[model samples]
Target: MKHIFIVSLALLSLCAVAQQKPNNEVSLDALTTETQFSSDSPDLVEFIWWIPNEFWEASFSQDPSISASEAQEIVSLVEDYTIVIALKGKIGVFGGINYEDVDHIQKEFTVTYNGTDLRLIGEKELNADTRNFISMMKPMISNMLGPMGENMNFFIYDNKKSPINVFEEGYIQFTLGDYETGTELPLGSLLQEKQCSVTKKLHNGKWSYCPYHGVPLTNK
Candidate 1:
């Protein structure tokens, strides 16, 4: 009886510990949908994607059967920050986005974290080998991006030179020349919100209620 009681107590303790652990089961839609923002007006329609490390983490965490080495490869992929800009449709169409609009935005595009302008990763910024490595990973990243990846232009930022602890500051801002949608995005706040039960995705921080379900959105 004493031995059985001890075993039961041990099992109960393990269960308690497991319940306390924060098991964030890697929600891809939540991560991507949360960081993504778009400016859709009668005149302009464009998507600005701030791809954080958490996005990559969630991406790699999808496959449970990946080996240890594969896991390390995933870790290496998220070392730098990446931004994907996409502009759809032809230029100079009435009441639609134009190529020139997006082109100007990219020319003047800038991203800041905790008030520091992140260095843009390019051939001039990174060594030949590192640049080549980034080039090689483009296909894999493109695949991960799905249909939208076709016309997407990637902008890599140097995180190693000036390491960004996004959670520490929890503030990231974007500026795209005269674009109304470009503004400061509070990432820390989004991280705290609950995912919509129906859509399994978090609404853009503006909505108190899920747009699809019409139900109140809570915080975790």
Candidate 2:
């Protein structure tokens, strides 16, 4: 717990050093709704979600203490991977999540993009540059999450071979352990409005796929 707070404070200090923005330009709640997507499964006792670069960009962009250049530099460092964090606890229960469970889930995670299932790699498996990059940003993620960040472990999917344009894809799928019907994050729809590629049908930005044609929606 002491280590967590220390790391979080370090991140806050870094943010303070950046250029300031106007007051209350954007709220964390608003950003969470757009960036974080949760699963609807009632059987699982844990709360897990995927955080894309879009969230970090918007977070830094709207933060009063962070500069645009600093934000871009930080985001660009990990632009080639997929990030997901998980904690063992019920949603809306602000208490600490199990620390032991973090290690367990870190080893058992999967990410699916464009119907291709990919295994998630733990932090130790990452290259030195990427590892260093995550070390700086992980604390910021924990700081922003507050209690939810307690005992949380991050899992990464190396998509460099087949990069994922999260803003262009319909949705990204995440699963931990044997939990089927994993969380599907409608990242593209949340980041920007999309339209059907074939029919040019306009969706209300609620879904990433066309209802009729059953295909991924394209950015509008």
Report the number of clashing residue pairs per model.
0, 1
**Per-residue lDDT of 23-96 in model 2, one digit per residue for the tens?**
23434464465545445645345556566666677677777788888878888877877777776544344642
Each prediction's Cα lDDT score? 0.57, 0.61
Compared to the true structure, candidate 2 yields what TM-score? Answer: 0.60
Q: Give Cα distance to truth, residue 38, candidate 1, Å.
A: 0.6
Off by over 4 Å in 1: 1-24, 82-105, 124-148, 180-220
Q: Pick the candidate with the highest lDDT.
A: 2
Q: Candidate 2's error at 137, in angstroms? A: 3.3
User: For residues 20-79, what per-residue lDDT tens digits would candidate 1 score against the true structure?
Assistant: 112145456655666676665455545677776655555555667866577557557557
